[model samples]
Target: MTTGHPFMQAHPHQPLSIAAKILSPQMIQTIRKLPEFHLQAWKILDRWAFNSPEMLAQLEAQGEIVLMSRLLDQQAVEHQALMDSTHQLQNGMTEHEILEMCEIHTEL
Candidate 1:
């Protein structure tokens, strides 16, 4: 890891901790609202450290930071999709507009 990355510097021993902290409030709330099985996965992640086997596996495959970033990105995409779908349903959005919104919300 670079010595100057702010997230890494925030908690060298637990960089992913800083990753969680830096997330938007919406993202945190979405995480809290995750299903029971997903919440269990979060518990497993919470117990992981830089040297943990799972972390090490991710590190070896794509580097830890990249893996964490991708996970966060995926979560954000899923959360946005859920929120957009809910909004569309609540507003009785037209099929054409809903399709446009779906295209706009495509994941990076």
Candidate 2:
């Protein structure tokens, strides 16, 4: 994807802007351009890159590398919390209990 593409900062949480429209090339290139007809269709591409699972695999196969990502970062935080709790309990908490807790965590 081109880094230099123009973007609209439409939403605080989203990095890219939603375009008002995607115009045909013939329509966009005319001397009297309709700014409203142009939009950041680039975000459609961005969304697939972010939220898609199978699409990421295809992109990886194509050698278009991306950093590993997760939809639920809270899972990581929870795992860390569990690890800390288990370590603090060391001799007090049985291994079976820990394993059961881990299973419950995953189920939830």
Best by TM-score: 1
Q: After superposition, how far is residue 53 of candidate 2 from its true place, in Å?
A: 13
Point to the candidate with the largest lDDT.
1
Give me the runs in candidate 1 sitting further than 4 Å from their true place: 1-60, 87-108
Ten residues in a row with the worst lDDT in model 2? Answer: 15-24
Write candidate 1's Cα lDDT for 3-107 as tens digits. Answer: 322221223343235225334444445545645325322322333332254543444256435544654554555445546677674776542344345663321
* TM-score quality measure for candidate 1: 0.29
lDDT of 2 at 87: 75
What TM-scores do the predictions have? 0.29, 0.21
The worst-scoring run of ten residues by lDDT in candidate 1 lies at: 1-10
Off by over 4 Å in 2: 1-67, 71-75, 87-89, 92-108
Report lDDT per candidate: 0.41, 0.33
